[model samples]
Target: MSTEQVEVLVVGAGQAGVAMSEHLGTAGVPHLVLERDRIAERWRTGRWDSLVANGPAWHDRFPNMEFGEVDPDGFAAKDQVADYFADYAQKISAPIRCGVAVTSVRRNSGRPGFTIETSEGTVEARFVVAATGPFQIPVIPPIVPDSAGLTQIHSSSYRNSAQLPEGGVLVVGAGSSGVQIADELRASGRDVYLSVGPHDRPPRSYRGRDFCWWLGVLGLWDLETPPAGAEHVTIAVSGAHGGRTVDFRELAAAGITLVGRTAGHRDGVLTFETDLAANIAAGDASYLALLREADEYVDRNGLDLPAEPEAHLLGPDPACVTDPLVELDLAAAGVTSIVWATGFTTDYGWLQVDAFDEHGRPAHRRGVSTEPGVYFVGLPWLSRRGSSFIWGVWHDAKHIADHIVTQRGYLAYRAPRPPQ
Candidate 1:
């Protein structure tokens, strides 16, 4: 295989990878982006057809390119998001080598660069940006029994409820992914079972104001500087989808059964905690109280506000009248489909770098990793609460790019090769 050298090499060309590449280009850095498949393949292939962004279109864009005239509160379809990313790569003229699968990334011993081994070839770079996101890895809980004989699939593999086995569908995990999947499955005429878990609660709207509008007033999006020792706050808040906080009362009213975490599934018998209903109720209350506090803070601060319409906030009153944790034998109920919207994990086995923490995330300070010249962007939270969001990534990308330029002396160092 032929070897080529560049100043920087970016792995994975998703939203994060493309954003990092754009920033690097703005800084006049000589870099190349390696993607195992075409850019945004995850979005193109992993998401469901009815899957719309829980957040509005405004939050789904990348650096400098606004998702113009799109629906404000309307969710952008997965295809639209993929198309937007493709257009973004084109507009930025990102130096991307598509179909180049980075098999491993190791710190070049005794050298000031990193070695990126790919199926295409190997290349060395003084700087590496691991924009491969956390969602690449799917977490399949070990507790799910193999003999259950139900068609089980993770959120990444689930494309639609049509693929579900003919029967009631159980969606485990009440996070954004799980809730949305459950809602979609229910709408598709399936008896949907939702398993609730500990989740952050926010009103669809507070005081007739959209939650995002309040987030903006509270500096949620503009928080570029993270609080001391509060790095996880960024990731938690950005990945959070307040709209996924469905009205349990509404769900119950609609005849959907809520359940506790799946303790274990075996021999087609699904067991749920009896306290599942109480747990969901308490969790929803806690979330609502937190949102109220956030609203109060915004009012007290007297921040400038926009004229956007408010979202409808559902009260804690139970929407569903049925027992929360009613377990049904899947074999008896004829529930053949199980959608595991449990959540995602970060898989960095292919990345041979040393910057990852025990959780397999790059140990970084504001996008700058411990390994010199290595950086990351579009993490759940890179800087503040919104850093992982599309709009948030722009601010972060600019900052990381600026940091890279300042440290690498891009203004002084001439590229060994001309621009491609």
Candidate 2:
């Protein structure tokens, strides 16, 4: 019923949205940011208590503000990161209206703008930035069948190991989240089984230096000018799992049993591949080789490093063997929980725009959508390796903000608002 007008409307006030808002403010762009809940609620409520940033603190900051100079190697605790975002919002005085959930975002047919229908009211804007991150939706494998007896929870719902039922707990998905949760559960005295998948694995540190330092020195994180003929190449970096390469060898040393990808779960029986260990080991070696190549390139470039990258001697590698299919009797193992560390999914059902591809991702070229005046930010691989990382969003945000300013005069054509 109530209507407001603005030059720009930014949806979601998390890292991406906030970054965009900061850039717009710096450029004196008039914009309104709408957040469904308080900023950084995902980090405050969705993450576990013991979770620390997987990357160094330097990589965890937003645009101009850094997370501080201390604890560069150690990852920031979740609360610390959340507080940083809160402080950032206050520092910039971002024009954010919290507690307003956007129900729909449709192009105003006659106004050349978008009408964002929210729980509180409706707002119209000439340009819309879908900064709503990709993690809002969780992807639970359909292969996981429903069983009245076994309890299953996604990584988003999991807070700690205490929530699991008493028995051998099976954690599905061996990504960073899955691996970390499995490690915690096993350490908590629960017999844990981990389902491995196709994931990037790296050591938290190689030798004694943090892995990120090498990444930065090697220009792995500095792909602002991508090489010729490699425009579509996406450099892999760590994300929510912590930017640090996960050390699979460390996981094995910790006595965690690795299993194959989860096939299905029925009647309290979970089926997985028997060659999981071999697959995981092979995957680990491949990732290590990539890092080695990166290190070599850095050295060849004669880049002076503050610290020497350590060569990780993983030791005489164990003979690869097929993962034995082993089912843990929950009752016997006292494992009462199942945490699906499987990654996230993207859902844009509320967006009434034809800018997305078949996979539901916004069709964009470096943040500019096919639909004029529509833009996207905070997506994985939006531009380069660090695009979606906490510190990486700023680069894409600045570019998008610049584009919006340069093209502002051309967006005068207005579309008609749909009949209310």
Candidate 3:
């Protein structure tokens, strides 16, 4: 196979890869970016239809460009987000080659670099930045039994409710994606049953400001790891209906049956834990904690923010919580479909480097792996709480680029002088 040499090689031409290219160019590093599919392929195809960004336009963008014509407070459609990254790549003239997939990466023999094997050819680079953002592989729990032959799909493959079989849909997982899908399915007049799980219910907007703004001001977004009891908590906020807080109680009142986490399956019958009320209560506790914190911040700083009188820490328990279902016969409930919005996991089998932990996650400190010259970006909590955000990726890219520039012996590979 043909082989080429480059100073740096970045994998995945999504927003993270593109951002890395921009920073490397600014630092005058001779690098090339490779993508398995088209640029922003995940945003282009992996997401469900009718999905919008979790965050609003203004806050979920790169520093170099603004989402033109998109309302600052309004969430942009998924296609709009993909288009924004594509347009940003064009504006910056990012050196990206799409449709070129990297098959594997191994340490170069007798050298201080890596040998990357791609579908097109081979590339030898002194540094490799795995910008393949989070949400790489869809994760579907194996709790569902195989005996029951029903239509099942991951959230990544789910498109619309109209395409589903005409029957009740059981959406397992109460994260942002799960809740959104359940809401959409229920709106389409399908009987929807949402499986509740540990989640954080933050207000979409509070005291005349978006929750994102409050998080920023309150320094919650800079945390390196999730708070205690929230390690597996999925954020249960929605940007639909012009952005609103997701209330499971209200959802139950709106006719969507709520069930606890899936315990096991037997004889075409699914068993649920008795934690429905506890799960909802946990979410409410988080919601109230955030509001109290925000209220204190406003009062301490003497900021003139409006008060939400209706915002309370407690309310009457919904029927789903008070009397949760312990089991459901798929046939009896008429549930014909299941949408698994469990979550995603990264696949680094192609990366043949000892830069991972026992759990197979990259063992890195703020994108810098213990294995020299191997870097990571665009992962949740990589460096901070917002590391996976658009702007967060951009900043992390800059930091990685800077590290590459300042490393020892980097002066030997400085940019070549232009022709005189």
Best by TM-score: 3
In model 2, the worst 10-residue window by lDDT is 231-240
Report the C-alpha lDDT of model 3 over 1-420, residue by residue, as the tens digit: 568999999999998999999999988889999998999988979988989998999899998898997899999998999999899889888889999989999997886899999999999999999999878898988887666788989999999998899999999999899999999999999999999988899999999999889899999989988777666679999898889999997888888999999888877888999999888988998888989999999999999998997887466888778988999999899999999999999998889998999899899988999889999999988888888678889988999999999873554777879999
Give the Å shift of residue 117 in candidate 1.
Answer: 1.2
* TM-score between candidate 1 and the true structure: 0.85
Location of the lowest summed lDDT over 10 successive residues in candidate 1? 232-241
Summarize candidate 1's per-residue lDDT along 1-420 as a digit string, tens digits: 678899888888888888888888887888899988888888899887766665666555764677654666656777778788888999999998899888888887786778888898889888778778768778778766766677888988998877776888888877667766777777778898887755554555555455666677666666766556544211112122334445656665666777877777666688876656565656566556657666577568775544222333454545332444445688777778788876677777876667778776679988898777778877876877777677777677788878877877754687688788
Candidates 2 and 3 compared by TM-score, better number: 3
Candidate 3 lDDT: 0.90
Cα RMSD (Å) per model?
Answer: 5.5, 5.5, 3.4
Full-model lDDT for every candidate: 0.72, 0.74, 0.90
Q: Write the residue-wise lDDT of candidate 2 on 1-420 in tens digits.
A: 669999999998888888999999999999999998989788898888777776778656764777863365557878888788878988999998899998998998865788889898888988899898878788778864555356788988888878776667788877667877887887887777777766555555554456566566566776654446544322222333444555555565666666677786555566676656665666666567756766676567765544334543454333222435655445555545677777777778888898898887789988899988889999877877777688788888999999999888556558899999
Kindly indicate the candidate among 1 and 3 with the higher lDDT: 3
Q: Judged by lDDT relative to the true structure, which candidate is superior, 1 or 2?
A: 2
The residue pairs that clash in candidate 1, if any, are 105-352, 208-310, 249-318, 249-319, 249-320, 250-319, 252-320, 253-320
